[model samples]
Target: MGKPTGFIEYLREAPTEREPGDRIRDWNEFHNPMPEERLRTQAARCMDCGIPFCHTGMLVSGMASGCPINNLIPEWNDLVYRGLWREALDRLHKTNNFPEFTGRVCPAPCEGSCVLGINNPPVTIKNIEYSIIEKGWEEGWITPKPPAHRTGKKVAIVGSGPAGLAAADQLNRAGHWVTVFERADRPGGLLMYGIPNMKLDKEKIVRRRLDLLEAEGIEFICNTEIGKDLPAEALLKDYDAVLLCTGATKPRDLPIEGRNLNGIHFAMEFLTGNTRAVLDKQPGKDYISAAGKDVVIIGGGDTGTDCVGTSIRHGCKSLVQLEIMPKPPQERAANNPWPEWPKVYKMDYGQEEAAAMFGADPRTYLTTTTKFEGDENGNVKAIHITQVEWTKNDNGQFIPQPIPGTEKVLPAQLVLLAMGFLGPEQPLLDSLGIERDSRSNIKAAHGQFTTSIPGVFAAGDCRRGQSLIVWAINEGRGAARECDRYLMGSTDLP
Candidate 1:
């Protein structure tokens, strides 16, 4: 606490965003940097609570109440307020391996539990975090520092997503050799392809980290799928230990009528193609385009939001997002008390853009897509939707039953299915002979990274099923520690 009265003196302020009209014209990030002095003032809003729940990373009533990686929020907020930027960056790096990525896209659970948020607006934690990390990069404070000693124990991490990267970083720092294998041409799994370029600039953030990891003596083998391109037995034989971080990549499909129409696509296909085109500077003529097309996005979650943003960038003619869940309450109910208010309504970046353009939130809650209708050319032309209500069935399970007369037909030139993922595809897991849990996630107990096969372990989304980037990093780090301990009698990594 640099200033005892800082919280009172400063009101919450965040980075300004590009105007909707102006930003939608380009795929660049929409956020405008807050002035340094104003950012310092924003940082001053940290309350220095007796118990800073913002960094605790616990789930209160099944909702995340803080940073999942246990980020040291107050300490860095104080440092930033005092203009000790390098120190703030140091404090941030202690807990989080990639603040730039989290700062840009992560929904700030820490702010929801902030003590200041109970009465006043929460501190601008996300903005301060983004500023600190960007500053760290600009000042050349971040660089590769490979471990001085080599333990000669080799560890192979499958999947170059957040969890795999985190584990590799930790294991490498502990002096063990680390190699990350990625199926995609690029190293970052979802972060590289699944997430669009506007929210997270691939080169500036994702590839930048990959470069640093490479310089730190972590080897990345891109386009080398474990099961297909490279045999699982080779990994088992070449490396002392294997850590599976393969993420849940299989998209959940809407298996209703006309599902295979030409213009209908999984959300990832549209997103990944858009990103690859941007990076490669060679968007093909046949590429999926939303420009001037009436678009309907199914499933309203982070992925759906991303679809909205990307479609906006593509100059979509009209956009609508459908959700099966009921609309969340505008304000936290009595049942959702302090440190449990994140579920309350808040417009994300995409929704904000949509509202600015469409004059309303694009979401149609308590609605589900019944079927798709295709035209003579085998292109999707419309979707049949129905409103549904949740009711407890005879078995005491909440089931969605469609309303009798709420069906509607909406014209759509392009339909994006963003219904989330089922689990990791089983082909690779099957090839490795790795066991899986009931959820089809790689069968490994939490904090115990070892797979049924000796010298093989699993972590990240593949092990835990689809999850957040912060959780991926946490799992990666944990798996790295356990792998190190398994390889070398002990590990110094935290």
Candidate 2:
């Protein structure tokens, strides 16, 4: 350890976020970075515990409680503590392929599984990580280092999200010719479009990384859909190995009354258009305006939070977020003790902004929408909902039971369904003749990314179903290693 008593000498502190009122006016990143000296002190707080569970990257109570990419947290913490930033970035890149993306968006399960978190708050590992990569960029230390030699083996990665990018990056570094096909207008499947511009500045972060990867000899083909524009078989005939990282994008929908109303839209439709408008400097027809209207968002996860923040930016008159499950406790429950990915309540930026403007939190827990009430023009006017309670069915599975007499209605000119994704879309999978699991995810073992088809592999959400960005990166790297082995009869990727 750099300092045996470092943990005792420093208190956990995070970078301050820009005031909600001011930040909501524009779509930009809100967190103001902490001073260099203070950040160093924060880095010094890493005790570098003997076990170091922070990098274990294992499932605890069925939730990821640590860094899934297994970042060299302690090594970088000590490096930052000693002012070896360039070295710290190198250590970080040893495991994680994209610290910048994860630094800004990841929920930091590493902190939850920190050994020190058993009693005291965990070290500011995420903040330290953010600082390391940012400093590397500011100093022009990050540069494209194309492979010294070519393996002449070609690999095609169908998807340019985190997972595909990571796999492409690794395989290219191993001297293989790599090509990434993106169905969107740009590379970065979700990073370029799905995420809000404010939370993650697209041009500054996502495109910057893409540019570097391009200069490093990775080929990117945009506006190409594998199953539509071109046949899936084209990939198999062209490349020595084919890896699929197409994310789980089939959104789960609520097929209820008035579903075809004009104001009701999928969360991606609303979010993607807003980001496109921001980038194009003009709103398009696809953009759904929440301005001067009451907005109701269904689902309480990150997508719902993004909708809240975006609606606030659009000057929505009022907002309400619905969650079918009950509110999580303010602290961990008895069954969810230390080191188990604590199930607790914490306000995200969107809710904080909603509270600031609307005078109360927007989330309503234990609720279900029964039907939609719409105006004669086919625009949704309101939604009928009922309070619900969870009870175990005869099979011992908990289900939401509607409580009668608790039915009510709320005004909503716009409704966005932020419900989670089901799995990868089926067209491409079926076209390629790849088998699927019971859940409809590509049938492939976890570490082995090979699908039912020979010389074809899968990774990320397509292989494992919908999941966090960190986990996607993990699968990508692992899949790359296995694919390299399959190609050359040996491998050396991590």
Per-residue alpha-carbon lDDT of model 1 for 219-320, expressed as tens digits?
Answer: 988988888888989999998999889888888998998999888989999998888888888795436889999999998889999999999988899999
Top candidate (TM-score) = 2
Candidate 2: residue 482 lDDT (0-100) = 92
Which portions of model 2 miss their true places by more than 4 Å? none
- The TM-scores of all predictions, comma-separated, are 0.97, 0.99
Over 400-422, each residue of candidate 2 has an lDDT whose tens digit, in order, gives 99999999999999999999999
In candidate 1, where is summed lDDT lowest over 10 consecutive residues? 340-349
Q: Evaluated with lDDT, which candidate comes out highest?
A: 2
* Model 1 global lDDT (CA atoms, 0 to 1): 0.88
lDDT of 2 at 267: 97
lDDT to native, each model:
0.88, 0.92
